[model samples]
Target: MEKLAGMLKRSREDWAYCARDIMGVKLDSEQEKILLSVQHEKMTSVTSGTARGKDFVTAVSSLCFLYTTPRFKNGDLISNTKVALTAPTDRQVKDIMMPEIARIHRRMVSKGFGFMAGELQSYGIKTGHEEWFLTGFKADEHNHEAWSGFHAVNTMFAVTEASGVAETIYDAIEGNLQGNSRILLVFNFNRTTGYAAKSQSSSRWKKFRLNSMNAPNVLEKKTVIPGQVDYEWVNDKVSTWCTLIQESDFNEGEGDFRWEGSCYRPNDLFRIKVLGLGPKESADTLIPRYWIELANQRWQEFVKEGFPRHDVLRLGVDVAGMGRDSSCFCPRYADFVDTLKMVHSGGKANHTEIAGITKVTLNTHADKYTGKKAMAFVDTIGEGAAIVPILAEQGMTNVYSCKFSEAATDSGGNPLTDLTGQYEFANLRAYLFWAVRDWLDPSKGSKAMLPPDDDLLQEATEARWKFQSNGKIIIEPKDDIKKRLGRSPDRFDALANTFYPSSQEAVAQDLSGVFF
Candidate 1:
């Protein structure tokens, strides 16, 4: 028994031994690579296909780090040997990782391994000490500060589902890695442009890629050899994927697997979910991804350089009717645009709460940019018309009601025409969207800026446009966009309303003045 205990203690330093011996966990070849990379590299990133044991790898790596590290005399954790885990949501950290850690710890204890008396709590592990033995955090973009102020000698910081975590949170975790600390980032290869995909080119990170086919159970009968057992647990995973692909009519050819039911096409979804590749932009997108990227860059620069205090601010509101869609408000100062608020009322918000919040946003911006005038353009469709009168009651007299079906007019009260002048847009909504396109066009020499919001970017890119038989440009109906996206493009609509050409004088004014 003494010899067995000593051997188990030594195995803590070897993750594979500890997992297989103490916890009775078995890892395949790719999972072994992930564990070894965590031990040997200062930074490791793994992008893998679905059901490739990512969570299992994370749990084993975390336990190995925790059990092997040195402890202090008072039983308090030595700052040098702490383990921190983070995910995009608290539920992931608490429900998923914590349970796995607790299960392994319980198994080890039952097998007579000398793990200290500890109970795994929701977001942490609690031993006899008042302070938590282990901690987990939600790496929200707005809450980067919460991830900071941690330093340790041989720390292990693990980010699960890292592709969904914000870049700012990653930056915060990077700063916290000190001394001989290491970081492990694991996620599905869901996006082509985020930090996870970009990390492959970075020399500092040791990267790993695994696919569903890598699992031993997914192999054909001929692939299995004597003494090497197949992973029967993954048979359902293989069967479901095969069935989904076979049933999909969109499959280009035989042996070509496609998931037709996904929001993205089969090829794109397959690349992201099964083949462990970054997502490729679809060819049919309306707004180019580059435009949104450039806009985000310009917005970041504007924030760093300081918002022009002298610039007049414009506000745009897209109201929700009796629906699940949100009421979105966007405020623009010069080239920079900020979504002031997105209120999800479940179609239950009272008039007073909505009106009060709108009034507060206007007053706050008005106070910030003293001596500058303010204008508001509001969507008057459905329940939105109620807000116009409410704003007027609040002494915001510069508000304009915008009806999508109304005829658009130029400053001279004539029918508004596009740059080509051959034909006008079908309605005011189409005209506003074209104006937004022109404003975002790099060739137009407009450095228009937009917030780094994923929903806004999706709305801007996915909303399509068409030319009417009469030669007028017509944007796709909002209902169609809502059906495809699973939500209304309220953010994009609010932004477009801000660029409505109500008066030529307003457009010509250099709102930035000396501040520019």
Candidate 2:
């Protein structure tokens, strides 16, 4: 009790004391840094990999922010101070964060600490004064009103799972930050945008990324901490969950990147969920800026510098008539794209005429390189379907009608995955775009040299993708893309169609049973 009195003055400035003495927790190095950062900085952002004890520390700091406050004039009890602990969902606050806080409050009360007194309830601790309290609730994307009325003078805002909280809610929280107020955000670091992303990315906030790779246990390859991130677990996740782009998978017609693998999905999830780096930061995107800029630089160098035109192996046609969308023809060499043709018919050409134009365009594109019509892919989903039989009648035997809505296929003409595979495609649209993304990867020895077309770059980079509930990568529908960009992604679509990721055998299998 005497030791507790001596610590009162230091408690206001020292969160480690409050954590160790009052809460009975010995924070790790990362947690200690977080606690001290919250002590001095107005805004502290914590983006963590799996099992880093950030939530535990966040709960501890929130509780400490409440208990360490100086008392009112009438008593040695706090008043007119508030700490708000919020998450994207009520269950998270009620089940995970608030419970930890309640347990700690109960421990402090049981230990006979005389300086602070508050009623410890379910998810709140309130002082005798009506205004003094610590509370937590759901502050999801839609709940702008939830952050309102939290205008306390010595306020502390702590958000858990903050990635799910929307920008409007963050703005509301920002508006309420006044004198002696601070905000702490702790989250899984999943998203690449939104206020949570800004908190990590923007220099305004002091940020910490608690990667599992750097965890003490993971580094030591042992259980240094009983429940912290471990080395073997990380190895398991890397082998089972993450994948690098392998060009031979498409070139050899052996594999398709079906989001998830037979069981292990080797993609960017490992970067966010395990490595804890900011990642290539491609969440919510089809192609990351990292890869897009790579292709752009290639265009400025090899293609823009007037490289020799080689034999064109593939030609892609995205057909649209007098509608808002333009008919785009993308010609891709073995490694780059230099020539492109776009026709905006201005409501003058029908699908039949467009088909005739397509056949002429294909012949022209081929004449530049192979002097014969190359194996071509035409978007035969809508009005473009009329162009298929018209071309077949024109003796265009090399063209394959592309049904964007058809089921995705691998190098071989299978459903999507064999029995051993786990991931599924949303449609052929996603599969083709994914192939374009793979083809444009800078790491590949033969990355695509693209024409530096602005619309192509915008559509290629801005197209969004997300995983379905079953954990399959799904591209945003073209209609949604049009809504966001205010025009159809015709050039990008044509560019995407250039990557028909199938070998000769796969094509033969598709032609045997599939429609032209």
Candidate 3:
């Protein structure tokens, strides 16, 4: 009781908590101090991005046990007492708040007071809808250098052979209201990387197979085309990612952390900080920024291609209504066409029209496309059936309504499915997964895809696959996609489905006068 009273006294005086004892177990003063310091550091100085404090805290927490290491034969009175008081919660210390404890000791040696501020800023109170706000604290970035170094080590170790080190290093890196909620982050972080090596080694990565057990919060949005392991989530906004690009030595004069626009300035350690967390509602605010940047970059790249050199062309349209999702038009057979255009369905009608015009402008060689050009329309899309018929009326003989396979079968008696056929689900899904793998793991880039703005490619990346015990796979959509990803990955899936086997066969078929 005395130890508890003493700890509470210190916690209240030093950490400025409204109350010390919460529920029953004594609130840790040491943990509070470290958390405060971290919070202080974050809002004031830059310390190793936003994840270093957790790393430091965990390291210190592990060392806390050293004080109880049977110092005396019977154990010193004070040491024994400390251990006796804390041992009951030993599991919590080692597993739950290890990082918080580590931050304290690290601060003591580093003489950094900013740690407290950083912790406070990071300490969040959740309102409904997965929204969070820093309670009685402001965001800061004090120990940028130290924090950056910490993140670098943590992220690097996480992706490399030192993943275990990362687990222990950043055990307290979450802002969940309860340990259970926070532990989910840890579990996902660890499990998500189980086959990371395989995913990264390939130039093209298949969607990772995930179950509700592996990720309960995640909602399945859709599956990849075919023959791949890619999946999409419709709504699972509660997620975060932190990575360390490199380590730096402050002796070289580079600070630990620096953010220039969305890109973090490369420190001597080459720290690359990437993190995403917030409510589904707020996703709208940030997603557009990423998309705009991505789309513009893609557009610029497309413009540089000058124009297509192909004399004969094959064009396609997969349109969408201007809802939350953007509408898009993709022109494949172009001379200058590279896989740089950020095309999708569900944007503005203007963008759709613009994309169509851009595709034609970029690919349609005036001299070559005079009479040899060809195009197709999948009537299922928005304005697709209507637009194609109108175009056909205007003498565009290439327009035709899409049809599901009436008589198609694979070698082994498998129904050549309309959903899976035209898209070449097997190869297309595999290719898109490989693209994700290349993005996740660049070193082992063996199975890569050619650069093309295929909706199927994007959809494949968003597709979610589940590998059964027998190795069979399934793809489907989830209701709560907003929680899984900031937005619906349906667009990406739709694009991936474009390359299904049936679609490939359809494309290969000569349509000289089919519409007529």
Which one is best on lDDT?
2
| TM per candidate | 0.48, 0.51, 0.34
Ten contiguous residues with the weakest lDDT in model 2? 251-260
Pairwise lDDT winner, candidates 2 and 3: 2
**Residue 131 accuracy (lDDT) in model 2:** 69
Task: Report the lDDT of model 2 for residue 129.
Answer: 70
**lDDT (C-alpha) at residue 504 in model 3:** 36
Please state the error at residue 210 of candidate 2 in Å: 0.6
Please provide, for model 3 over 262-376, each residue's C-alpha lDDT reduced to its tens digit, 9 standing for 90 to 100: 2122321222221211111121121211222233345466557664444433334445555545443433442222342334444544433633553354345434645554454
Tens digit of per-residue lDDT, candidate 1, span 1-516: 798768757675677887788776677878888887887788988887776667778888877776666456685655445678889899999887888787777777787664552666777666664432567878879976676546666677888888888878778878878776778888887775567765643446887777664556556533342223244533433344444432334322122333224312234555556656555554434565557767887889888987764767788888877865578888887677864578887886455666677777667667465665577777878777788777776666566777778666765567777655655888889888877877776655658888877778767876778788987778888989887666788888888888777563343233323211
Residue 191, candidate 3: Cα error in Å is 4.8
391: Cα error in model 1, Å: 2.3
Return whichever of 2 and 3 wins on TM-score.
2
Q: How far is 181's C-alpha from truth in model 3 (Å)? A: 18
Clashes of 1: 1
Question: What ranges in model 3 sit over 4 Å off?
Answer: 1-316, 322-324, 330-382, 393-447, 450-490, 497-516
| Candidate 1 deviant stretches above 4 angstroms | 1-284, 367-370, 411-413, 418-423, 504-516
